[model samples]
Target: MKILLVGAGLSGAVIGRDLAEAGHDITIVDSRPHIGGNCYTERDPETGVLVHVYGPHIFHTDDEEVWDYVNRYQTFRPYKNRVKTTSQGAVYSLPVNLHTINQFYGKTLRPAEAREFLEEQADSSIADPQTFEEQALRFVGPDLYAAFFKGYTEKQWGCSPTELPASILKRLPVRFNYDDNYFFHRFQGMPETGYTEMIAAILDHPAIEVRLDTRFSAEQGAGYDHVFYSGPLDGYFDYRLGRLGYRTLDFERFTDQGDYQGCAVMNYGDRDVPYTRITEHKHFAPWESHEGTVCYREYSRAAGPDDIPYYPIRLVAEKALLADYVALAEETAGVTFVGRLGTYRYLDMDVTIREALDAAAAFRASAAAGDAMPAFVKSPL
Candidate 1:
């Protein structure tokens, strides 16, 4: 089968690689001039530092298979994300750990004492937490939530915490210990060279042909046996049911002579601050020595048609719109939607690769069994 993959990102690259290895010819196309999609990285001309073109993407996962799968293409250096936040004129460790608690209130309380103190600070009145605000108040109390989460959430989501779902806040963990590592995953690492190099290597299979700076159209898609679209779900139909809401990011880039923040990501929890976080690119690959540093100040806003969609705004209204688009996708023949944009969810790099692998396996199985392919191998909702 000659399969057409629309989007040369992780999903398309991984899927194309697996399918091509299974003796099927694959042609992967991207609208952009590059192959890595949003995970693209390039070396800075002046500093020679590898800059994350879109933003910082730290690869971390608990899945052993997913971990091993990535190691095949590029070297995986051990990397753990330790985040910091500046809130209300104070800098503190993120995920609200013991050190953060001790520094914020100016007391050296032990883990047990800090846990008990937070319980006391928590609002016992709220029986059940529904929204982000309610969840924060119930778990960490008003003062901590206001300083650490509220302002940051407001800027990131472009809405009040009350309007956001409790699930969003639930994703973040509040630690009782001094351990300040951001993720709780068993395995965490970044590609030694860069994500683009890893992805490019994946697409280097003999049966695959990569087309950069190519746009996908109905006529173009019809030429192939089947289409695996990793582009936006609404975009497949040209946003006929109205565009699903998304929060895109704008990166304000700057260079410095040496270490700027001394950390990879420094988040600003002050709502008054226009941007959410500052990412120092050199810190991502600290093993390599670099004389200069590249940084990015990230800002979030409602995505326009021309803007690159970063985070999907899957509120109630957006979910309804998504269902309509999903229905349309399901009814459409010879097409399968895959990845974050295709499914409209915030996916980590590992999850995206895992899904792509599974999707490819499903395609091969379907081909072998002479069965029809699914519109979505994984559910969007």
Candidate 2:
């Protein structure tokens, strides 16, 4: 079988690797000059610090299989994400824990007491919260929401919390204890060198050919037996239905001597601050040290035609547009849509790899049974 993968990101690389191992020829093409897509990492020429080229990507997952799969290619250094946010003229730990509650209110309340205090502060009137602001007020009340979430949410999503969906806030946590670790995943780590090198190792098979700085088109799918389209779903048909909404990020890079913020990620909860967060690239790999440090001030905005799309804005309007695209995708043949862009969802690194692995297995099973491959292994809606 000859497979043409549209993008050289995790979806293409993982699927291509699996198919190649199964005696299939795989050709991967990417418009970007690198293999890892948005997760690409490179060392700073001047500072010698390994930098996550496009914002920070912390690998954290509860799936043991995904953890083991990545470890096979590179050394997995144990890492935990401890995030801090500056809000209301002071700095505090994130997730709104006991320490944060105590610090903000000037009280030494314990875990249980803090929980009760937040409960008291919470609005009991809103029984079924639909908006992000209502949800926040119901859970943590207006004071904490205004201080920590309101400004930050407005900055990140470029909208008021009142306009956003309640589902968005569900991903966030309001911990009772002092646990500040960002994720609840069991396995959390980063590659020793960088994501690009690890991805390069995955595509090193003899049956797989990787072409960088090459853009793939729907017309090019004729040469191969099948096509794995990991690019944007709307892009395949030239966005005939309409372009789906996406939030793109812009990084403002700067240099500093020694440690800049003494942390990997520092969130600015104030909307007036302009940038959402400041990421110190050197702190991502704390095992390595350098005299000079590299950092990026991340800014979020609605994606334009030429901008790189970071997150799918699956609001009411975008959902309808995505449905039209999915219907069109289903009518098409010889191409399978996979990954974040294909499915029009914001996926974590582990979730993306897991889906890629599943898609590969499904394709192999379909081939063995002489069944037709699905346009989508997982539903976009």
lDDT of each: 0.94, 0.93
What would the per-residue lDDT of candidate 1 be over residues 1-381, giving only the tens digit for each residue?
A: 999999999999999999998999999999999989999999999898988999999999999999999999999999989999988998899889999999988999999999999999999898889999999999999999999999999999999999999999999999989899899999999899999999999999999999999988756878889999999999999888999999999999999898899899999999999999999999999888898999999999999999999999999999999999999999998999999999999999999999999999999889899998999999998
Instruction: Give Cα distance to truth, residue 73, candidate 1, Å.
Output: 0.4
Off by over 4 Å in 1: none
lDDT, candidate 1, equals 0.94
Clashing pairs in 1: none
Q: What TM-score does each of the candidates earn?
A: 0.99, 0.99
Task: Give lDDT tens digits, candidate 2, residues 104-178.
Answer: 999999888988998899998999999999999999998999899999999999888898999999999988888
| Model 1, TM vs. native | 0.99
Candidate 2, which ten residues in sequence have the lowest lDDT sum? 88-97
